[model samples]
Target: MFTQDSKRALTAAALILATLTCGCAFESSPRGELGADQDLLKTCDPAAPPASFVQIDGTGSSNSDAIAAERMTAVEAIARRTAVCSGYLRVTVFSSSSAATAVLFDGALKMDGATENARLKRVPEAVSDVMNKVRSAYAPAVQALPQSGSDITAQLRLAAEWKQQLGGNYCLDLTVFSDGFQNIGVDLGARALSRQEAERLAEQPAVPKLAGASVVVAGLGRVAEGAPPSAVVEGLVSYYTKLCQRTEASSCTAVSDYATATR
Candidate 1:
């Protein structure tokens, strides 16, 4: 058996080969999957947080479902995207069925959070981890994405547009997942998705790029998908690294109607 050091060396060599050859051999996600294209993503300032209103309807449950089901939702799904120029982020949340989805109701972009500090408050470790990963993993890609470092300034224009809409101050609902118990003031209930739908959706086209940045599924809510939680989470992480344009402007709440899928 390979020692841990040897295994790590192999992994590093593989990462280098994959980067130079731009090969799909190292890791890849399916078509139509949630984060398949995230590798093409550019790094941004995590300290400032994402002002862009990018919504992440991950390959799993929606924020609305968590609150209505009184389920425990714990996830840190921050990502970096070229679309945002600066990194774009989306947080997954869970709460009692009676908890309000209103907190999740960010008008346009449909990417809202509970209270202003949700990202930093609930799971700061996960948040910090994702930001650092995005910065470290996507650094070369972000630098190489444009012809010159000066061109990066122009790219920021696109980022500015995305940010104007998603600036902080949105409310959100995070789900709980541990076996530990907690007291609730209100009684509530709801339903989760069938494994078939989740599985089928998993096969959908991923965003198209999964090798550029650090794609961590910090907090994944439990589901009937049935692979061990680690396997499922790892799979989702692979998937998240692949895709881009999670929800095009057409479905984007930011715009009134379809923007046409030119890509």
Candidate 2:
């Protein structure tokens, strides 16, 4: 038997507790938080918007002698920053001899708002893990792959295929770390394309099937043994740019430095 005033106070306390519990549950619910996170990502620049699928192409330029630490760091940043929660990252290293691609990080990464810093910090470590695996296991297993030289078109096609298999709404980000000299599977015959020839060829339509995904072509100007000349790099950039344009990519550009490009 409680006094009326005492009962009223208890009722008020109950209501307050219920309200707080509901609020906390909403904030912690996976669906509720995902919606909130997506809203935050919308504020990002359209050019640098969050990604649904990020594919890293590690070919001759990325794994071989041309592998530049600076460029790799930049690429790692792009892959990490663009990766949104519930997205996927696929890293592939290919040579004429063999190829290997793996999902380095998969699932929701919580790319909204304050999580950006955490995501950024996570990217470098993720890249290191992937690269370590590449150097140790992937490279060794594929050592006998029989070097056919660099076959870039095939790599892009593979990336597109992997993205398509996801089978849903996704913003694709394709980052190619390469020296931009593709010869093995190119139609120009066994000989690499000269800068002049590459320019003329780049004018032709070479659209990828990644739908509306954007592309970032970095490390395009590196030179290595059997790599394309510096002039060829310029032509390759133009070629990829045209390809991206024809495919209606969100954005596409060849960056000299990954760090500078992202900034």
Candidate 3:
């Protein structure tokens, strides 16, 4: 034990043993604290990310500076939320004809893999880019308001179709920014529609099947110029609720303000 060579040999052996032990521990305990931190770094659910669709009513009644401002705020919130989860976002403008409906922005919110702190730092910048694009696309899309009529039902159908086409185990979220005025086929503004009537209308074949989807009809009965009476607003809410239910959606929320419609 007193020999210098023996001491050095023992030191080397100990070092090798330590190295092997550490390697074995790392291989066997891949789910340890450090590994868990790496796992937690991924903020988005890779298997079932949310697929969000926003439909803006580009009709005469819904066009206003105030409404546009509110929409921008709502869209920013939505874009931030979606970006945080690395989900999908689609913005569309709907008017009289579904055929004439325009998709302003359709893309995914993507983030790079990094440490939690790094991810947090990068999130805002990523979200800002997305919101900028959304705003740019939305402005021109809604500038020319349609005067023919509002085809709200057709918008729902289009969303359903888009969801089907985007096949995945995605959580569907549909947000419609509208005044809840249906003038295409069924006139929701003629008179206050009864719940029974709404039920019947929802049951029609024209209604899209949106099973397992979450639906939010924001700014319901909130027109730019003339606000509908309370009774009419109530009727609009009932109609949308029944419509969503008839489509077999998991949840339905029809609110007067876009801010209140957030999940």
Candidate 4:
């Protein structure tokens, strides 16, 4: 038993402690991590020419035709038109089974240097070739989802590794084409993850951190042969948002309809 005044004081102290604890948690939370470092966002080169590194998920999908067409458009657009880079601009593609060599050059084919123009001219052609390679990486049939599912976490790790190699020397614009159904390589403690669980899991250390990058994720809602449930679509948007924030990407967006994604 306690006197009234003492009890009030104790309660107040407890409330203060709880408030402080909650604030600490939010400050350290994965969602807020990227915003914490305002400097990293500011450090990105505003003048840097846009560069695209596209990774196509080779996991089987039902609406692959739409996904492929939209994805190829983005690739061709980026390859054919990009600002001249005094330093080499890197354009590359990755699929579950294969990866294309980076087309590196200083400027576009229209640039004055013959060597630079020649290298730049090859990028679009190389991207076309890589698109074919990515198509082959997809499953042969809708029912033929691999025994192993899409390893999106692994792919994210790879992207982070690439960013590290790039070493903040240039701003990165990354694009990922996937159905947003991440499975197989993810560890959910031997069981499936509920939406809430999956979203929480994305904040954990298993996900890599990226800084000074902008990421766009396309082909989210559509699945192999049909569309995903609305709930799943919403969940993926949340999941990608959380994951991107953890990476410290300056921006992140998950678009279901690719036709309008660029807009």
In lDDT terms, which candidate is top? 3
Give candidate 2's error at residue 220 in angstroms: 1.8
Error of 3 at 42 (Å): 11
Model with the higher TM-score, candidate 1 or 2: 2
Clash pairs, candidate 2, are 85-109, 86-108, 96-148, 97-145, 97-146
Give one digit per residue, the lDDT tens place, for model 4 in 1-263: 76653453344333221221101101122434223222222332445534445566655552456556655555443333332232223433333322322222223222333664454444445545544544454334223434345666566677777656755345556666677674444443334446687678677647676665667666665565755566667777677667777777766666554432121
What is candidate 3's TM-score against the reference? 0.77
TM-score: which candidate is best?
Answer: 3
Task: Please give, for residues 76-135, the per-residue lDDT of candidate 3 as tens digits.
Answer: 656655665567889888888778677877887766666555554566787678768777
Query: Which ranges of candidate 2 are over 4 A from the true structure?
Result: 1-68, 83-86, 97-138, 141-144, 185-199, 203-206, 225-230, 256-263
Q: What is the alpha-carbon lDDT of model 3 when measured against the actual structure? A: 0.68
lDDT of 2 by residue, 6-108 (tens): 4533443332212211011011124443453344344344432334333434444345533444444444444434443334455555555225444434443
By TM-score, how accurate is candidate 4?
0.58
Q: How are the candidates ranked when ordered by TM-score, highest leading?
A: 3, 2, 4, 1
- C-alpha RMSD of each candidate structure in angstroms: 18.9, 17.9, 18.9, 16.2
What would you estimate as the lDDT of candidate 4? 0.49
lDDT of each: 0.26, 0.48, 0.68, 0.49
